[model samples]
Target: MKRAGQQGWSTTEYLAILTGLVVLWRSSQLVLEHLAEHHDEFSWALMIPF
Candidate 1:
């Protein structure tokens, strides 16, 4: 079904969403780099036997 006057996201909303995604990606990159550099201090998750 469709509506004649229905509208989708505006340009500003799209830009805001894109900007948010970029921030999240960059933050994750920084965190991962930090963790990798200090690999000896932090350990990976251990798997327990079922």
Candidate 2:
């Protein structure tokens, strides 16, 4: 049925978005750590995210 197909599509879309968010969060943590160690060098750049 059309409703079942739509549900399947939505489930896949939800999973894709969830995965993307996890990847972004992990990368952001890494970037923040690196910037923290070199704070003086990227002080202005850090403001963009904040």
Candidate 3:
């Protein structure tokens, strides 16, 4: 079996990615809540994927 560091992601790298994801999730939730509070003034457009 390959060690974590040897396989490319060390423990620190995993922790960093996890932390970043958590931050992003929290920020997105805040933004959505703000938009919901001011739905009349804020609108979100969905982008269509080709």
Candidate 4:
């Protein structure tokens, strides 16, 4: 649906947004792998304070 003054994203804008999302996804994957490999070190993270 097109709005009166709002326009669709251009090719460059679309590509930039896509690239940003890819970067974030890839970074999260890497962080998750690292955390998994060092799971023991992060055990304290499960502790909750009242």
Clashing pairs for predicted structure model 4, backbone only: none
- In candidate 3, position 7 carries an lDDT of 57
Residue 14 alpha-carbon offset, candidate 3, angstroms: 0.4
The estimated TM-scores of all candidates read: 0.66, 0.65, 0.64, 0.71
Query: What 10-residue stretch in candidate 4 is worst by lDDT?
Result: 3-12
Angstrom error of the Cα, residue 30, model 4: value is 0.7
Please give, for residues 1-50, the per-residue lDDT of candidate 4 as tens digits: 77644454565688899999999999999999999999989978888565
- Give the per-residue lDDT of model 3 (tens digit) for 1-50: 88866657676788899999999999999999998898866444434444
For model 2, name the residue pairs that clash.
none
Superposition error at 3 for model 2 (Å): 1.8
Please list the residue runs of candidate 2 whose C-alpha ends up more than 4 Å from where it truly belongs after superposition: 40-50
Which candidate order results from sorting by lDDT in descending order?
2, 4, 3, 1
Question: What C-alpha lDDT do the candidate models reach, one value each?
Answer: 0.78, 0.92, 0.81, 0.85
Q: What would the per-residue lDDT of candidate 1 be over residues 1-50, giving only the tens digit for each residue?
A: 55544334465678899999999999999999999998866664434444
The global Cα lDDT (0 to 1) of model 3 is 0.81
- Candidate 1 vs candidate 4, lDDT winner: 4
lDDT of 2 by residue, 1-50 (tens): 47988999999999999999999999999998998899898777757964
For model 3, state the Cα shift of residue 11 in Å.
0.5
Best by TM-score: 4
